[model samples]
Target: MSDTRPTPIRPRPRNDARVVTEAAELGTVLGIWAHPDDEAFLSAGLMAAARDAGNRVVCVTATLGEHGTDDPRHWPPERLAAVRGHEVAASLAALGVSEHHILGITDGTCAEQPPDGVVRRLARIVSDVAPDTIVTFGPDGFTGHEDHQTVSRWATAARATAAPRARLLYATTTAEFAGWWEPTRHTFPVFLTDELPLRTPRSALAVELSLDDARLDRKMVALRAQATQITGLIAALGEERAREWWSSETFVAAEYAESRSSWATWQVAA
Candidate 1:
């Protein structure tokens, strides 16, 4: 039998915001990402929202994102892994996540085929934690990075073996509106979900969290706390200004769900 699964077709966002409300409190959620700041950039708000709604959220990062820093002053290869690991721990805490696990794969590269031992280890963790939902990079890896792709692939496989009842969600890009696309470069921004434009046949479920300016400010504060990653950008744009730029986050559900239609409770609009 083929490992690939079918994708679902979902509805476009309604002009009416009332059609969607806050998602029901999920029992437990596991977010698997390739790097330190991936959670903050892509799903911090969702994590915050979930936590506020009383869900247990945990993170599994595949790599330290050691290759991502531009400042050679702080990130020599020898110390990058350790530094980024600490940063991941700190960042997840800021997001209200109490539990975190790092697979400790190589910073720039991951195993072409993750070892059966690695899979078993991840499976054991998942079985113990037993999250109701698993979120990770889509098949395109958001920008088709090999490491991100590898983690997503492994997360999917791990979901099957570890917790078959868990809902698996591959985080994907949504239609670009606002200044989301790289206007100057005429491409997707590097190292973020803002760049991918391809559409998959997968059923997509949308989740939107509405926040007031005060809450948004708090979110941005948490974002800026990860100094190793976005410090320069935060300095240039100022904290609140940068938050305004990417305040509203969007994600699409791909594979792992029986029907996209059932995800409507997770959707909320402005």
Candidate 2:
């Protein structure tokens, strides 16, 4: 039902000098995200849990999310980009991920970029890291955002070239999460199309995370670090709802989706 990797040990101080166990048991985790806060919203718990278990976690942001705002006059691209750079650094730091790369791709334009060039650049990172696991959006882009879909395409190509053995997990919603999201979905019109967001069943998720208080609190900290992005949502939903909303995370394995009927097996797994 779920992936074979186990959750890493938790709660030790970041300064713990104890020698870590063989990281290869789960191996290095690489997250390639379209924007800064996407990582926090979709996979913070998973990444934090991996780090707690002593895995090396690396983050890659394709863009600075410069165009993510209601008022461009107040938040121009250059200014927003600078702010998001700091926000992403602080956000990743909160999850114990110090190694990060920003590809400097302009926000909201990934679909317009040359695919071969982008794929080559991503392939270089894959070659360098040799990650055991790669996490990113699915073909749906998790919200049907064009930039996200482009990044997913590039990551898929890169992984096939450089880390074919690595597990590729795409952020996914569960049926329960989809039902839970109804009331709050209006507060955040993230989905670009009516057919967006393929939801997996809980039993079939490659990874399903329901964070404990400590981890959930830590995840909240990471989200809060991206204030420019998530502050309004938190305020609109109220802190309690915001916390409850993100308390869970889930994913689907790309291998199974390709080998079988896409998401059909997961639907039956329930």
Best-performing candidate as measured by TM-score: 2
Among the numbered candidates, top lDDT falls to 2
Count of backbone collisions in candidate 1: 2
lDDT of 2 by residue, 83-134 (tens): 9999989988888999998999998888779999988999999999999989
Question: Model 1: which ten-residue window has the lowest total lDDT?
Answer: 261-270
Looking at model 2, how many pairs of residues clash? Answer: 0
- Candidate 2: where are CA atoms >4 Å away? 1-25, 258-270
* Candidate 2 clash pair list: none
TM-score for candidate 2: 0.84
The deviation in Å at residue 136 for candidate 1 is 1.0
